[model samples]
Target: MAGGYVVGVLTETDNLNDLARGIAAGWGMKEADIPRLAQSLGQPQLQAQLAQGLQDFSDDNATDFFVIKATGTGAQTRYRAYTAIQIWPDSAFPVTRNVAGSAAAPNTLRIFSDFQCPYCKQLWDTALPEWERQPNVYRTAHYQFPLDFHKNAFSAAEASECAGAQGKFWPYADVLFDQFSSWTRLDPKDVSGRFSTYAKTAGLDTAAFKTCLGQRTFKASVEAQYKAGVALGVRGTPTVFLNGIKLMDYRSAEEQAVVQAITSATPSAASIIDARVKSLR
Candidate 1:
C-alpha cells in the first residue's frame, strides 16, 4: 500500500496583501520595508509551520491531510489550505436524479439548484456545458433546493422531478431554464399548464406528465431533496458539491478549479486503512 497521502495546499494572497499594506501604512514604513520585513520574518518557514500545524490537527482528528500552498509574491504572499474531511457518508445522499454523463462514471458532481434562479440558470448555461464535456471523467447529479423568495421555483422543481420520472429530466430542465422568464412572472396557477407545454417540447408524454403533475407524484421527493440540501448546509441555489466537497464557486475559473479538486482529491486515510485490512484477509 502507498504511504501517507499528500493533500494539495492552495493559498490566496489578495487579502494578505491588503493586510500587509494596511500594517505598513500604520507603521509609516516605506514600500520596500514590506518585502524586507516579510523575508526577515521567514515567510516560507512560517508557511511550513502552519502547514505542519494543520497536518497535525487533521491527523489528530482522523481527517485527510490536504495540501497547503502560498499564493502571491513578496510581502503579499498568503497561505491557503484545504482539508478533504469526510463529513457525510456515501449512504447519506442516496437520491441521484437528472444525471448527465455516463452512469458508470466514478466521479459525481452534485448540484443543488433552483430551476427559476437566474444564477442557477447561468451555471447551467455557462459552466455545465464545459463540465458535461468531460463525459469520460464524471457525471452530474441534480438536486432541487428552491429558495423561498422565488414564488414559482418550487413548482418548477416539482415539474422537473415529474419529468424525470418519465426519463426527460435533463431536456425538461433545459427548457425550464431557457424559458425561465416566460413562466416565472406568470400566474402561479398557470405554471402547471406551462410545464405541460415544456414537457411536450422536451419529448415527454404530455398526458402522462399532466397526470403526474396533477397527482403531484414527485412532490415528496422534491421536498425531501430540499430538506437534504438544507441538512447539508445548502443555504442558496446553485450550491455545488464535487464528490461531497462543497465548491466555493461554480463560475468560469472556479469551474476548472472544481474539476481539478475532484480529479486530484487524495483518498482518505480511513479508506487506505480499510483497503489494507481487506487485502490482509
Candidate 2:
C-alpha cells in the first residue's frame, strides 16, 4: 500500500489541557489550517473528518497532531499544506426581521429561498438556529425564489408575501415549509383548496387571504423576486447570500470556512470560495 498520511500540529501548545483551553477560547486551529490539505484529500472528504481526535500519542503532553492517511500508490509524492485565516467585522445591522443587534453587531444575512424546496426547509428548520444565535453576526432577509419545476412555489411564495404584508412573513414562511410535503404532493390544479386550509391554519384572515389568492393579488411581488433572483445568478432553491456574497454548499470545507469567516467578519479569499461552495453542497 504505497500511500501517504497527513497530520497537523499547533505550534504553541505545550500539552493536551492547553489545547483544550485554546479551543474553548477559540484560539486553537483545525487541520484545514494546514496548507494543501484539500488538494491532497478532496474537499468532501476533508469536511467529513476535519475534527479528528487524537486517540493515542507517544508524548501526550508535548504532542498535538491530527493525521489523515492517503491510500494510493505514490511514494515520491510531495507533501504540502496551507492555512487560510478570516476576519469578521462588527457592523450595525440596518435591516432584519427583528432588530435586536445594532451597528456594533450587524445581524443581517439575507437568504434567497423557495418555500417549496425541501433543502430550503432543511436549512430553515436546521441550520438557521445555529446562525440565529450569533445575533451580532447577521440579521436575515428572506426572499422568494420559487423554482419553475415546483408547481405550487409561486403561489406559496405569494401567499407568504401576503402574510408578510400582514406582519407575519416569518410565521407564514414557517407554516409553508411545515406543510410543504402535503402541498407539494398534491396535484397542481387541486392545490388551492389545500392552500386555503394552510392559510387558515397559519392564522391568516381566511376569507381575505383566500380572496387574495383567488385573485392572485401578490403574484407580481413574487414575480419581482424571481426576476431579482435571476439577475443575481440564482438558478435554484435555497440559494443563500451573506451580505452581498453567495454562500457555498452545506458539505463544503468552504462552508465551514464561511462559518468561521462570518463569525469573525473579515472574509479571506479562500473563505469566500468556501462560502460559495457550501451553497452548492
Candidate 3:
C-alpha cells in the first residue's frame, strides 16, 4: 500500500462472507467485521502484496463485496482501481444548449461529448435520438468535451455552437456525426472548411456560419464547457448524467449500472443510481 491507500483482491465467488473476510484479511485481521471496515481500514502497507480475498462481481447485479486489501505488488491478477468522485447536485449542470425537448421536462440528460470519439458518434447515432424522441422521458443538454488528443474536436464544438447561433444546433450535430468518418479522415487544418460545407448541408446561412466559424466566436464557450466537464470528474468523452446523478464509468466491469441509471424510471432513481455507481467502483 502507498499514497494513503491499500489494495485488496477479493475472490470471484458468490459467498458474501468471503467478500467481507477478504477485506478484513487485507488489514492483517483474522476475522471479517463489516462495521470495522467503514470505520477505519485505510492503512498504508510497508510493501504492496497480492493477497487473496473474495469478491462477488461475477453476476450482473452485485450487492455485496469482500473487504480485503491487497499488499505487495507484482502479481498477475485482476486489480480494482478507485477514482475519487464528488457528488454534484442536479442544478450544477444547467442546460445551456438544450439539444432536445424542454428544459422543464421530467428527466434531464446532461452529456459531455466530443465529436471525434467513435463511441460518442455511436451514442449520437443510436440511443441519443431515441431518447430525444421520447420528449417526456428526456431533455438533453449537450456540453462540449473535446479530448485533447482529438485535434479537430475543439473546433468542431465551436462550429456546433455557431450552428446553435443559427437555431440549428441539433440538426447540425446530426450532420457532424453522420459525416464523422469523412471529416476525421482529413487533416486537422482542413476540418473547419469541411464543417462549413456541412453547415450548408444543414441549411444554415453559409455566409453567416462561415463568418462565425472563421472568427472563432464560440471558442471560449466551448473551452469553458470542457473545463467544467473536467472539473466535474469527466475523464473521457460522453460522460453523462441522468437528472444530475453522475453515471458510472463506461469501461467498468459492471456495464448495466450505467445503463440502468440512465434508463430507469423508478421514483427512487437517484438513490438507485448512486448505489449502483458505488457498487461499480
- Winner by TM-score between candidate 2 and candidate 1: 1
RMSD of each: 10.9, 14.0, 10.9
Rank by TM-score (best first): 1, 3, 2
Off by over 4 Å in 1: 1-87, 252-281
Please, what is the whole-model Cα lDDT of each candidate in the order they appear?
A: 0.69, 0.55, 0.65
| Candidate 3 off by > 4 Å | 1-87, 249-281
Q: After superposition, how far is residue 114 of candidate 3 from its true place, in Å?
A: 0.6
In model 2, which runs have C-alpha deviations exceeding 4 angstroms? 1-107, 250-281
lDDT of 1: 0.69
What's the C-alpha lDDT at position 201 in model 3? 98
Model 1 backbone overlap count:
7
Candidate 2 accuracy as lDDT: 0.55
Q: Taking the candidates one at a time, how many backbone clashes does each contain? A: 7, 29, 17
Task: For residues 33-87, write the lDDT of model 3, one tens digit per residue.
Answer: 5555433333333113314432333123122223233434444333332222233
lDDT of 1 by residue, 12-69 (tens): 3444454344444434569977776455435667656543433322332222333334
Compared with the true structure, what per-residue lDDT tens digits does model 2 show for residues 181-261?
888888878888887787777788888877887888878777877777665556777876554445557435465454444
User: 176 in model 2: Cα distance from truth in Å?
Assistant: 1.7
